[model samples]
Target: MNLEDYGEGTLASAPLDVLEDYFAAHGWQSERNGDEEIVAAVKGSWTQYELRAVWRAEDRVLQFLALPDVRVPEDKRQLVYETFGLINEQLWLGHFEMWAASSMILFRHAALLDSASPAGLTLQQAETLIEAALDECERFYPVFQFVLWGDKTPQEAIAAALVDTAGEA
Candidate 1:
């Protein structure tokens, strides 16, 4: 659907707006940029840092865009990988990782609906929506699997199933 359908200046044009409001209700000020990015304060049990959500909508399709956290580098990407594991360990903690984890869930679930059985989505005319969504989720790292297994790789069984179903969309 186009932004206009949601109404001018309405929250419909941006999913991040919903997320920002959700965070703000919890006492956090979610700063948005260019209608595509959101950065917020994250409080750990004993520490705090800025958490960011970089997102984009292109060709009327939406995906969770990655933030350019320059503070995180190549060597630190490994640290972020390990941080993925650490986040799993503290899944219940209210932190940036928690938001990431939650965001992953929301996106992936919507992707599933978009791809396998849109049911009633207007985009059903576009058969590749599900595959596109899965492709994006896979690229972004399936946080659900990361949380459950502490690894970025999908389970062999799931990988094989996905591969088998790859063209079903």
Candidate 2:
């Protein structure tokens, strides 16, 4: 995505197409953006998680599906936003709800990764976790229905495989 090109202090909002291109290049797909929201899928090993880039007053922000359920520390969310070149403070200002901005899930993911909980995550289990997370994401943020990262089948297949693996385990 060459996010470095955007740099800091750029007042211009990242166009939806540009965001799509960046995510697409990373193997993300099935993007759906409307007047108020943008949604897509992301690949995590063998599973896919839904990612929502909600528009906040013409500025684009990220929100993940099913992240509210994940426990994470504060400050981590802001780092995720920084990684994408979005101002985390702007997205979080005055928003008391976790789902209102993209930071919460990112923070949780970061915490999880840092803590090594995501290590040794099988493809099937990973898909199941992402699916569960997306369910929460949809419940909290309904304006999402895009496919980014990998195709829908891989996600479903990973989920199914996880279920089978669980039975065996």
The best candidate by TM-score is 1
Candidate 1: tens digits of C-alpha lDDT, residues 47-158? 3434444444443334332221213333334445454454334323122232333232222122211222222123332223323332433433334334344444434323
Tens-digit per-residue lDDT, 17-119, candidate 2: 3445545655767455563344666655424455554434322333323233332235344433232232223233211134444334432221111112212
Cα-based lDDT for every prediction: 0.38, 0.36
Question: Which candidate tops lDDT?
Answer: 1
**Residue 161 error, candidate 2, Å:** 23
- Cand. 2 Cα-lDDT: 0.36
